[model samples]
Target: MLKSMTGFGSATQEANGLTVTAEVKTLNSKFLDIYCRLPRVYSDKEVELRNLLTQRLERGKVELSLNVTRLTDIRPGVTVNRPLVEAYVNDLRNTSQSLLLDVSDSDLFKLALQQPNAFNSEVSTASETAASDWEHIQLTALEAIRKCDEFRQQEGHGLESKFREYIQIIADRLTLIEVQDVKRIPAVRERVRNLVTELMGSDEFDQNRFEQELIYYIEKFDISEEKVRLKNHLSYFLEVLAAEEANGKKLNFIAQEIGREINTIGSKANDASIQRLVVQMKDELEKIKEQTLNVI
Candidate 1:
């Protein structure tokens, strides 16, 4: 089944009093590009997480974020700077006196606590919390990635439907071109005959030579070969679309070939009706090209 490069997924897991939330999003890109936002404690796991995502997502611009919340009051060492707090209290009291405002001691203490560097929470050098929560976090991340892949598959189905619809439209236009082509030849033959008679200014011209020239002229404008090749290309495009592999790039190349054939037929047709059909076909092919870029 085909997959699209655009999708989003999120998963949450809790273990050892730590709640981990993982979110992943992807967008269309020519190559795999990964960006991660991880909590400071889990920073060391960035490389491993990137590898895992790369293996699963294949190609796209991928963004991942992990947020960790402690669910329990128990934590590592944390300390209050008593001297800093005293300094903040003194500064606040002096400011209050200068402004002739009376500030309560409780309010001063609260304001001092809100100051930067008022307290320090020490992170363990061994990353004990990160190590303990790694397993649960990994599982949550993997589940999110799995959901993202499912989202991609769903998007892919929609894209496939559109591609098939556009291809069918192009095929129908080709049919119109074929029908018009049949009538075009005889009309062209008559016009050429009239023009030749007018130029010679006589009805008694070399019949055999005129026949040869007319045949050459009609053959030059014949679109039969392009029509056949275009039909085959349309069939091949559907075949590739049905395949299980993700062939977005391959499909794009085939669309380009289809465009080339359509352009050739339009230029050689010399018929306004056939040219109109070619224009319609080109429009459908352009839609296919646009959707193929998002395929994976």
Candidate 2:
């Protein structure tokens, strides 16, 4: 089945008191190009994530981002060092006594608490938290990838339908060209015969040489070979479009072949009617080329 390169997906999950979200977006590209935005803790996993995307999506310009938020408190903000506070308080009390000054018990306690090393603002270790949450983040990313694939499938279906319509229009125009070709041949012959008679006096013209030259001239403008080749190219295009594997490059190459055949027919067809039909085929082929860029 065909798939489009343009799509978007995201997934969010909660684990280990953290909320994690994974988002992915893709666009058409000749090769797989990945851009990653990750939290500092998961920086080491960027290579693994890129490999996963490459294996799944194959070819595209891909952008992935991982976001995290704390959902619950994992540690206290601060903790007091009881022994350090007591030591400071004892030293302060001794100094007050030697100076013959009395200090309130509450004041001494307050002064000790204010001393450096008495308490510490807590900082949770990220290594441990990241190790525990990695699994959840990976699973969320897989889910997002699946959703993006589904989006590609839907867009591809629409493109396929359009392609079928455009191909049919070109086929219809080819038929018109065939019909006009038959009428064009008789008119061309009559005009060429009259010109030959006018250029060379009828009595003086050599009949054998004239016949040979006329045959050669008519063969040069004959579109029968071009018509057959064009028909084959059109059939091949439809066959590839129906294949099980989605090969955008192959399909694009076939389209170029189809255009080549159409151009050959246009240039060889001396009739105005055939030229008009060729113009219509060219228009439809251009549309097909434009839409194929988004295919995968």
- Output the number of the TM-score-best candidate: 2
lDDT of 1 at 194: 88
Candidate 2 error regions (>4 Å): 75-129, 195-212
Distance from true position, residue 103, model 1, in Å? Answer: 40
Per-residue C-alpha lDDT of model 1 across residues 1-296, encoded as one tens digit per residue = 88999999999888888898999999999999999999887788899999999999998999999998889876546678889999999999999999999999999999999999998766783367557778889999999999999999999999999999999999999999988988998987788888787647766677787777778877778888999999999999999999988578999999999999999999999989999999999999999999989987
Error of 1 at 248 (Å): 1.4
- How many clashing residue pairs appear in each of the predictions shown? 0, 0
Give every collision pair in model 1: none
Worst ten in a row by lDDT for model 1 = 121-130
Model 2 Cα displacement at 193 (Å)?
3.6
How much does each candidate deviate from the true structure in C-alpha RMSD? 9.6, 4.7
Best by lDDT: 1
Compared with the true structure, what per-residue lDDT tens digits does model 2 show for residues 29-108? 98899999999867999999998899888888999999988888766567898999999999999999999888998999
Query: How far off is residue 53 in model 2, in Å?
Result: 1.0
